[model samples]
Target: MLLAVTRQHEVAANWDAASLLADGSVSPEAGCRELPGCWGLAQPGPGPGDRGPCYAVPAAVGPQLPDGCKAPRLVCQLHFTSWPDFGVPFTPIGMLKFLKKVRTLNPAHAGPIVVHCSAGVGRTGTFIVIDAMMDMVHAEQKVDVFDFVSRIRNQRPQMVQTDMQYTFIYQALLEYYLYGDTELDVSSLEKHLQALHGPTAHFDKIGLEEEFRKLTNVRIMKENMRTGNLPANMKKARVIQIIPYDFNRVILSMKRGQEYTDYINASFIDGYRQKDYFIATQGPLAHTVEDFWRMVWEWKCHTIVMLTEVQEREQDKCYQYWPTEGSVTHGEITIEIKSDTLSEAISIRDFLVTFNQPLARPEEQTRVVRQFHFHGWPEIGIPAEGKGMIDLIAAVQKQQQQTGNHPITVHCSAGAGRTGTFIALSNILERVKAEGLLDVFQAVKSLRLQRPHMVQTL
Candidate 1:
């Protein structure tokens, strides 16, 4: 006998009337003993053959059902039992396997397949979530398992009962999505699974290459070595001061009374002076190309010094002279030659050439030219992969090592920010390596006081 029970009336109408009525319908008042071919076996009695054309009625009837109702008429000979109640224990491996099964089973049929276990809420919900996620994956849609579960629970409560279950589903989905595996591949999955257990898991490394490249571009080289005072007791008195007289002429000064007149005359200055100070004037200071050569002849100074703000004409002249001597002096310095006007001399050529090319000196020179820049405040922002800065710093160090100079001149667009940060970091790193102290904050702070905003951004 067939039986049917559902919440909807249409479901009852779809029942096969002829087959259900085959044994002849019984009245509602008829007892079980009077019913023909009736066998009240506790179990589903042997199969269909042993208990033919008889339906057993459940003893208990709630108020919802009619009092005079007969046995529930089965629909289509398929027994439909209300979904049973069962606890779905959380198991990572089991969940993964189940998801795989659901995917496989789904394709075998054209219609929707019923999936329910026990309460039809816990395990059933989990099954549906996994299935939906797999469908999304198959469709090339990105999703996170935890987020998906949370969404499901928002609609249907108690979907994931425990954290363990949530974890299982999370792993199962990640295994399939990230590694592209339908079945769990222990070796490959474990690697990512291990990441989930660590603090760094929150960091997404998928685009790390791009980030690293960007970082490389903006990296400012902080390795700067100081060029100390000129060696004592030099033959030519080490002509260290060269101030531009005007747009073209420069005043060359050296240490007084050094008795090195012959060296200065042959190498740089064409004129002679015993007082150790002379003005080296270039012709026209305008259209005269020979003016640079003439200026080189005035003092016979080894280095041509100027400020960074000078015209290109002066800068080119300095560069021309740099090849002749071993190095060129460029940077800002304030000396009280007189009280009122602060003489801030920045070698224009030094700034332009250093910005354009790496520092390098001839192989023959034993004294290296080291350019040092100290920024007072406002740390400069550099683009990722600061190749130009790297090249410049490297060149300066190479020249310094070759020429045996101290205190490389460093500067930024404004002679601070980028300049100071580089110097401070370089000094800090040097001190750490030499003295084993890594703290640079206090030192940086002190420099910032002289010039504010000198710290590099973390």
Candidate 2:
């Protein structure tokens, strides 16, 4: 429970104030460490004015503890410089963003955390109320704001100092729940189980049983028949003809003087914020590799998520279209490996892709495309465990966020099973964060409308 920073002088004078934790000067006193330098302070920007930055503080530098009292060796302080003590933040979204940063810095652990503000009440109380209610919301699906605040006030008399601050707590909780800052109390055992297996077999299994009861549902299967602008000659170019239906598949519009038809076995998938957040496609075959690069350039995609490797279990899953060292020309698209790193479960390659425009004077246009190659997932089945998959997805998401939200290209062997599941999980978790609960059945159902056989299992 930390309040937002107020006046600069208050930070200088009040050692325990939130402002001091952020931009305070160093103390020359015996145990007290010097400011700035002592904290190893660095501003994580978007910061002209205090959006807040995190720093490390050595516990030994602070005042001595009572004899035999255990003390933490290192203290990490996440300071908010945004709001003034007199008022709430200009926007709740900014506070939510800062709180998310704090959580990222300090994940859950089995211990009571120390929270304080200058007065130990105002903003401090607001933060505690919001966090407690947020936790309650995650554990259970709802929260009683009035009851929770009353309880906190009983423990710490006048806990929330002002009515505005009290209102802010409610606002923050709502913003976090509805705008994507969800935290769940998933046990380590459940996570382990989920990582190894897909989802628990508790949901939608009955519906799936009923759906599979019929040999084929004509209503559901009809949506896959509408392939727009798909020429008959280019139909055979698709890796898996039956899985990718026409309606939901991504249609690449042809450019002037293009040698081949603008066709690729890819479809758009929705994300939390964007309708076409990702383009789910099959791993490129030897002939379609050039088309893949063309799609990447045309879409201005910054990230390419490769779920299947070039070869898996002696089968050719994807073509090695990317160059190992130098540049490789695929039709009018030339991709050069600027840098690459291969880890155990995933490989990240930074490619400098140049698109040649014959009609233009410059002719060549370049952009950086990052390719995340997931090496462990099997071509025909899910991963043996999900931790690596989760990590890989998280890394890709972090990059996407930093690089500006663009339509990412995700692909596997046929891009129907593994590819669809990956997209579904990403969207489902986002929906949970944004809307509190998830509807996996609706998520997969909507996806199947866009691309058939998505989420291949219940």
Candidate 3:
């Protein structure tokens, strides 16, 4: 059996490793049931030229043999570390030699070979195709790689997952054809490959490509677009969208009046250390201005982060939701201007919201909320530079900490673009501050799970 070993995403390493340990038999010990039986049979066997850390499992523990057959089945597991997940080997000659070693170990092709990579479709398929094609070449003097790959895929989908991998099959066959078993220098081929597939000194481009592949899975993404459980009015009132099967949509309660509007285009988005610490929503639509204020009052939000300008390119992006002059009354809530300060690249407006109706607690009538409008932030792109955005996020966090613990309202034109970016940046930045390290890929993936299409662009 061919065992492919490579670095895996840390979060999925345990699960992926578990799948690799099982042989064809069921063991009596619960913990060792799934482990490769070879581990318990004998000491790790010596490999050919340090190419593999191979192991041999005795025939006694092999899957139950035929009732009357006394013959034994010997299993040799060859573990090669040359290949990596989602990546082609630097040179195919080394792997070609390894495959030849595998064939030499089991000359008669005794048992059904179990070859696998992380997903069991990428590197595994590449090794199988090359090995099978080389056999055909020795007997027939020619091979059709495409037909072989197509036939293999008919049985198992997504075999030889990338063009680079497919191309490697041809390269290996060509090398084997030109210089049979004789060793040939591969430095030139490695140079050409580096030119074709970028430098691999730091991050693995192949791994990133694999990640992008999983991110673009149409089936799972379409499943996230379902909205049957959402209220009809909420669906109609949405400025952005609700991910399907997601129940995190913010629901604002109305105690007095539902005549004006009952729904506001808003959703509760979580932060690094807190749940529902930030609310992502669209800029206040003219008709929903009062509803927006009611949300701020009901949720006891302390800050409103306005990412876009009030107007952009003659388009009224956001209505003057808060009081522009002395004071403004939106339905039952009266907002009085307390202070306005423009610092650096942001304009900060503080307001005291008081309720007209009598409340259960006398001290709960008035609530203070701050609106920080960041000027020069474009409608369709990220901030000019990261520093301004970072500073703004820091300021928001500082104010939230000083003020009573409350959710912050963050919004842009559509609420899913710039707003999501800001929230993701803040959450990741905070996580880095606390944890001393961060995984941008995992961070973004988690954010999208919470609010679909959040941080929409890479």
Candidate 4:
């Protein structure tokens, strides 16, 4: 959302000045009353490092007013997490959609929009220019970005700082002229859900279908699978058809000059609140099983969701990577089952995973890992009921409440169909719970940008 202000806390926290911010969050009960001169946000049920772009934080700001009243100011803080520092957003559409919601909250008549980034210039100016550019488009069907930028610099030097930042102003404006906002509100959720599930498109394209087309067609950046296609790494893929793009592919920690060992058929997919929220991968092949556990250890993920059985419908869907009863060692990693609980819909297993340190190293490392296996859906077709998936996601969320929202490892047969669908649902549910907004088309499109053919079932 800026030219230099990249991360969340670097821009602003709890709608306060960026300079006075740190990387800590407050519970709802412990408000700004504890910190005299600082801003505090009542976290709305998100684990640490889990809050995404466009999260609504209930904040309490301390006052140094002349009136001498020591009351705290209640504020609604909107944070956008994906905008790269000194660069434009990957999806200009997401920025425009955020702008729409911002206008809703900060009406012109109410007061001036309070905008600030780290340096008080680049990102701040870009947002102000975009707001003005869109207003000009609406009123006169014309925009003079150069003229506006020149004017803004007169007021404050270096408003739109970088060449990419200047170019991005036009990109966002032109995107509005090309593809209008396609995000869905919570109020109209039923209509789109019906369009997705029902046989209603007789002649005209369904609304959801049109939205999906827009999402796939207009990717602003060129995407390619560079490292995954190398001759050395091709053997690791479970399904040749699906591979992650080079941009968001999860890279393994390189040992001292280790070659090609870092490649895995996994992409870091974004959840509603954070990037790399899910490490989506293919079902572990016999040779690739060790790489899968290595990914969990490297990424420090505590939760794994397996969407298919070891063999489904007489076909080898996944290899049995874990032991049925006791501990199993793969490479240096030893996984022991601490407990197993199964319901009609899901099987929850807790494993005590230990990595034997090298003889030179001082201490052994151990972690508690939880795997949620759900095989209720049919292998060939859709599920009999949607509630099972919703509840299954709820159970995963319950575990995330304990794990503090590290990147979750999700695998299906090809890590494309059911894996993608589950991630999209997880993202949508999280966004809806926090912001009351849904854009199924945008959600799936974001996934496909990271990896190929996510949400393949839909």
Which structure among the candidates has the greatest lDDT? 4
Model 4 C-alpha lDDT per residue in residues 74-164, reported as the tens digit of each score:
3445555456533567656566766776676554555445665555566678878998999999899999999999999999986877777
**Tens-digit lDDT track of model 2 for 292-356:** 88888888899999888788789888888799999999988889999999877899999998877
Q: What are the lDDT figures for the candidates, one per model?
A: 0.33, 0.64, 0.65, 0.74
- After superposition of all CA atoms, the RMSD between model 3 and the true structure is 15.5
Candidates in order: C-alpha RMSD to true structure: 34.5, 13.4, 15.5, 6.8
List pairs with backbone clashes in candidate 4. Answer: 3-86, 52-273
Most accurate candidate by TM-score: 4
Residue 164 displacement (Å), model 4? 1.5
What local lDDT does model 3 show for residue 237?
43
Instruction: Order the candidate numbers by lDDT, best to worst.
Output: 4, 3, 2, 1
Alpha-carbon shift of residue 185 in model 3 (angstroms)? 37
| lDDT comparing candidate 4 with the true structure | 0.74
**Model 1 worst lDDT run, 10 consecutive residues:** 265-274
lDDT of 1 by residue, 135-237 (tens): 8777877666777778888987767554544554566676555434322233454564454355443354533222222222222212210111123212211
Q: Show where candidate 4 strays beyond 4 Å.
A: 1-52, 55-82, 140-144, 192-204, 218-224, 255-258, 358-364
Local lDDT at 386 for model 1: 40
